[model samples]
Target: MTDHLGSCLCGTVKFEVHGQFDSFYLCHCEWCQKDTGSAYAANLFSQSAKLAWIAGVDAVTSFTLPGTRHSKSFCKLCGSALPSIQVAGLLVVPAGCLDIEITMLPTAHIFTSSKAAWGQGLRDVPEFGGLPH
Candidate 1:
């Protein structure tokens, strides 16, 4: 099992996820897009893994979509996404919240029917390491 360290954007919340992720998904569901404010939400899923809060656990807050199983946890201060324990023994970790580099690639793209049109076919767009001049 591998251990990954992560923190909130304001560094108010810190945690470690211990064990291998069973799968990684890039979800284009409208809910995911709304929560992440992006074209898709990248998440790692695990059933056998565990979460340990290293600091500021009290700063973590979660919200579940009304009448749905969808839920998200984030830092109360910075509002950055954090790890969450979903129902049915599933653990979810946002891919971008980790402090260390991850080698695991996404297993699939889900809810593609809700995908945004403006986000498509961007592979041919210009690439830059930073803001363009």
Candidate 2:
């Protein structure tokens, strides 16, 4: 019954998802990496959660790969990733888009075979609380 609020980087799109996520994943597939412009996509999956747009629903745009199931929802203004429905039943929410705290961690790194060669050894890098000056 928990409600999660989310918005685009430009604040042009706002929404809420009502209910808990059933699974979380860090997808490292090439499509996910391309969609996120990162090494992986952190996504939460929910089959029963309902998405309600609070504002600017028209500002959202979605693209599904021409010959694949890969799809992405993003804000038209800032191109920030947003939530999208998949496989007709599951809702896929990008973890970074949520305004509320996420209690569930990623369950696994999926499609590791397609991960970037330079994506490994990230833990070996120095950690910082903020940008290192």
Candidate 3:
């Protein structure tokens, strides 16, 4: 029963997950790209893990994509992505929100058929420790 702590970017919400993740995924779905404003969303899924809100639970807000099961939760103040409880007892936690380091690698890249054209060959791009001058 490993425990992981997480917080929103503005420190408005804090939470903990007490159990191991079942899987990790990098989703390239269009809604994921639009909501994240990035090529994909890095998420961890757990079926048996328990989630606890340590603080500022009211600061969290969620949205579901109309008729789709796709849903996301974020901090109202900073708008940073947080954890969400999906259908069938699935807990989806954004990897970026975790305060502690995660040892698990992504289980797979999902929705690859919708991968962005600009998302390819990212490894070939120049790496910088910080923003390039």
lDDT of 2 by residue, 85-131 (tens): 98887899999999989999788889999989888989898999999
Return the lDDT, model 3, position 83: 97
TM-score of 3: 0.98
Enumerate residue pairs that collide in model 2: none
The order of the candidates by TM-score, greatest first, is 3, 1, 2
Which window of 10 residues has the lowest lDDT sum in candidate 3? 63-72
What is model 3's C-alpha RMSD? Answer: 0.6
Candidate with the larger TM-score of 2 and 3: 3
Q: How many backbone clashes does candidate 1 have?
A: 0
TM-score of 2: 0.96
Please report, in order, the local distance difference test score of every candidate based on alpha carbons: 0.96, 0.93, 0.96
* lDDT of each residue in 1-133, candidate 3, tens digit only: 8999999998989999999999999999999999899999999999999999999999999999898998999999999999999999899999999999989989999999999999999999999999999
Q: Lowest summed-lDDT stretch of 10 residues in model 1?
A: 117-126
Candidate 3 ranges beyond 4 A from true positions: none
lDDT of 1 by residue, 1-133 (tens): 7999999999999999999999999999999999999999999999999999999999999999999999999999999999999998899999999999989999999999999998899999999999999
